[model samples]
Target chain A: MLLFLSFLAIIMIASSHNAESKVHEIAKLNNEVRELRTHFVDGKTELMRLKMESSIVKKMMQKGLKRPERPPRKIIVKN
Target chain B: MAVKEKNILNRLYFIAACMFVFAIAVLVKLVNIQFVEGDMYRQKGQERVFKTFDIPANRGNLYDSKGNLLATSVPKYDIRFDALAVNEKDFRAHIKPLCEALSKEFGKSVSYYDKIIRTARSNKNRYLLLRRNLGYSQYMRVKKFPLFEFGANRGGLIVEQRTVREHPIGKIAERTVGYERRDEQGYYTRVGLEGAYGPFLRGKEGKRKKQKIAKNQWKPIGDANEVEPQDGFDVVSTIDVNIQDIAHHELLAQLEKFEAEHGTVVVMETKTGEIKAISNLGRTKTGRYYEKLNYAVGESHEPGSTFKLMTIVAALEDKVIDSSHVVDTEDGKVKFYDRTVRDSKWGGYGKISMAKAFELSSNTAFAKIIDQNYKNNPRKFVDRLINMGLGETLGLAIKGEGKPKIPYPGDDDWYGTTLPWMAHGYGVAITPLQTLAFYNAIANDGEMVKPRFIKEVKTWDKTRERFDKEILNPTICSKETAKIAQEMMKNVVKRGTADNIRTDNFGIAGKTGTCWGNYGKDKEREYISSFAGYFPVDKPIYSCIVVIHRPNKKKGYYGSEVAAPVFKTIATKIYNDIPVIDEVSYAVVESNAVVNSYDKYYQNAQKYKTIMPNVKGMPAMDVVALLENMGLRVKLEGVGKVKNQSIKPGTKVKINQTVRLELS
Candidate 1:
């Protein structure tokens, strides 16, 4: 009976330690998720700023590309 | 001797009685502490080790209609230092390298960091701020610095993280996007979309119980929480980032050119009444511009000549006037009892049709049109405007829509002059958005749709609610009247006051208005230049409005000069930006070159086995395959069909011999 009690006690201790390790792992993962989110926001903000139309026009002006003065034509083919 | 012995025995008895009493007193105190004070001690011990915590739910993100981030809550890092965390020897050894790293990363002078650190160390400042509001990458870079990498207990690096609202688009629509804040008295200041959708964006918080395991560390006691957190749903607004960017820049350029006090522009989808872009800019004392307020939604002022559209629509629908009816300008000076109205031109336009009167925006013409036609029954004109939905607010999603006021026949401000003055857009008030809605209706074939900002509220893929087009009125005017108004507006750009802003890319039909504000002698009069219209005279898609207040009088201040250019640019750019689809017939036609090659390949495969077959003129591909199939290895040397072979042709079938065939 005494041996059985000690075995049960050992199982309880092992389980507690397992739980503690998981807690530490969760804390580390939470920190990593936050940092990744921060980096993602930074990249997205920069992309939106660069993709803005005004910025694109300014960039293309250096290469001599500008808005056309005339409207585009629609072509239709008859069979 | 017997008497002395007796006295000593008596003293011994007295001493024994005292010892017995002292022992009894000790037992009583022990029982008291164990039974009576035990509960208080146990409670104190429990209070130190266990706690209940409130876990905050993650706030939802705000997104544009194109699924781009408008506003979101992100973790911002503030780094602090514990000056005396390290011993004197360690501090001395690593201080120079630590300061050097900080200088390199943050672009501060080395002496700046050195002085601050030394001062902090001498003063024993436990919480010295190193950097505040560092982004994630910057925080990690600082964490990897030489001395700070040793961590909190030793190197004394402290980090405090909290969530803050961030706008990815910067200051483009900062005022319209807005935020929510709570004061010390627990009052929330809600502004714009965030404040409007607080219930959906702010989810329910959760709770959990934990036990203290180490200093400043708590271990959750169980896997399940007492209450689970519900994260906020993402809010998608109907703001096209591309259009917003163009509108913002175009308005800024015009405002800077005119050195205007303030300006506002709004572009809305005519069919659905979706506000695609809106920009409001105010000038600073130092000649800079920023999004100062939501003037498009909140500011109500007299719309000078743009109001003429409503007047014409009312008259045409009332069957009181037609485009062909001629109205004499009479030198462009017309009097209304006490006030005199004059045209901008010196000699005034000669007798012209009502259509010409509208295209030129003659104040006397419209004044005469409404005054003479409705003078007997002014109530008819006022009721016409009221029925057109111009005497009330738009009932917008965001708060603070300026109320539009249309004077009635018996109102306190009503006078004999009010009829003609109101004809020329005076003694009247309407928000810029309201005027755009009216124009948008004219573009939508008289179907008046309310302006909408939010497209939907959703969580991931499941939609909580969807917003559809809410029609305010079936028709603001008859189809015939709307057509006439559209044509006249197109004429305004084609050969009218706004001719300076004509573009070949698309047809812009609108009216230009330049009104004077603060006209009394006590204050200097300022010019409010505005243009209101829609584009593509054939089929209208979007209606836009631009209002610029108090432009410099020295430079041009007419609506044609200051405001119409912005309208034209926005319309032309938007028209050119729409993607066009081209169809290319993709029928597979068997070419002659392919068929000949296939026939050659088949003929070469039929014959030639285990013996030398004259393959000199044969294609390299056919030759290689023909030889290799008979248990020989094949190798190709060059490209396109085939050219030459290393071994003559087949010779004999070998188990593993490489045939180097060259291709042309």
Candidate 2:
């Protein structure tokens, strides 16, 4: 009985230590996720700013491309 | 000697008794300490080793209606160095390269870092700041730099990570995206959607019990957490990124050209009342413009000529005047109790129709018409506006919405000329958003819908709440009154004040408003230029308003010159993006060419099952598919129609036989 009780205590300690490591791993992973999300948002914001209509117009002016005078027309066929 | 020995024996017995007393006293003290003081000492030890740690929950992200990220919480790092931990040898060996790397990363001169680092080392400053508030990628790059690569113990690098709110679109919609921050006193300062939905965006914090282990690390004591944290729910707003971008740039460009003090633009969906874009820009001391405050939703001032729509609608609803009722402008000015109202046109439109009076935006004309109709009982006019929900607050989700002040008949500010002044949009004050909502109601055929910012609240994939189109009033006026008002606004763009802003492709119905502002007892008056309207006069989709405050008087102050152009730019952008569909009645024409080709192709395929057919005019691709499907290998040369085939027509085709087709 004494040996079994000692064995149970040892197992409990080992499992608790295992849980501690797992917790640390989860914390690290969460930090990584936050870092990745920050990068994604930063890149997306840059892309949106670059692709804005004003920016595009400014860029295309050097190429002598101006906005269209009339809107595009679509023909609808009724069958 | 005998006597001395006997005395010594007595001394020995006395010494033995003293020793026994000392031992017994020590035993009693040990027992007292074990039983009485043990618990107190054990608790003190536990206090040093055990701790309850708070685990902060991540703030939720904010997204646009199309799921584009607007705001999110990101970890920002602060890097510090411990000068004392570095030995002279390691410092000397790595300092030059480390300084070079830092200079390259932070865009500073290498000598500047070298001097600061040397001064810090000489002073033995343990916590020397290297960089503050670096993004995650920059922090990671800095962590791999020469001295920092060795980490805290070897290289003396100290890094502190903090979560900060980041806006993806940068300054485009900064004020609307907003932020939430807490001080040491636990008081929160919230702004915009971030502050309005703080409780939902800031989730519950969790707690964990931990114990101190080796190397000063705290290990969680149990497998289960004491309390689990709930991450904040994401808020989906109604802003369309494209429209917001256009509104921001156009407003910025106009404000800069006019050198105006500040301006705001709001675009709303007519049917749903969803705010697609709201931009407020104020000039800075350095001559740059930014979204300093939400002027569109928070600044209330006299709406000038835009308010005439409300007055005319009220008059028409009361059966006071028809669209063709004639009004005399008395040349250019008219006199009231103590004040005179003048039209911008030197010689007035003189005896024009009431609709033309609105189209010309004649100040004297509106003043004369409204005062003549409602002079007997002024409360009837004010009640007409109040009944239209113009006097009430919009109760927007965002904080700091300016309250509209429309003076009543018995109010202290009311006077003899107050009705005429209010009729011409001077005595009353309304925010740009309120005016937009009123115009939106007209575009919606008199059904007023409340302006909404947030569309939904979600946690990961689960939706917590959804906000729909909220009806503030089922109908503010009769359909007939709305139609008359809409027609008058359209006439303004066509042949009136806003003629310059009219487009050839589509129709825009709106009013131009230019009013004198800041006219105190002794102060000089400034002009506030504004325009409000909806597009595609026949079927309106969106309603927009642009208000520019305090434009340079020397350049121009009229609404048509300063504000209407921005509205036109935004409207034209939207118009250019959408394609116009032209529908025609379907007509079927019989063609002999198609029938002939179909008959020939069908007959040849049906007759040449086991033999190769002459495919002279047939396209190369169809010939290959035909020959290959018949279990014969097809080899093609050149392009276009098949000129010749090796196999003769009506010849038997064998399996694994190669058929060459020449094409041109």
Index of the highest-TM-score prediction: 2
Name every residue pair that clashes in candidate 1: B620-B642
Clashes of each: 1, 0
List chain A TM-scores, every candidate, in order: 0.79, 0.84
TM-scores of all predicted structures: 0.83, 0.84
Two-chain complex of model 1, DockQ on C-alpha atoms against the true structure: 0.34
CA error at residue B104 for candidate 1, angstroms: 3.4
lDDT of 1 by residue, B325-356 (tens): 89988897987787788998876787989899
Best by DockQ: 2
Candidate 2 local lDDT, B178-264, one digit each (tens): 888899999998888888888889999999888999999887776365998888999999998888989999999999999999999
The C-alpha stretches of model 2 lying farther than 4 A from their native spots are A72-79, B1-47, B82-98, B118-126, B146-157, B214-217, B223-225, B520-522, B581-664
Q: Per-residue error at B166 for model 1, in Å?
A: 0.3
Per-residue lDDT tens digits for candidate 2, residues A1-79, read 9999999999999997888689889999987887898788677777877877888899999999988777899999898
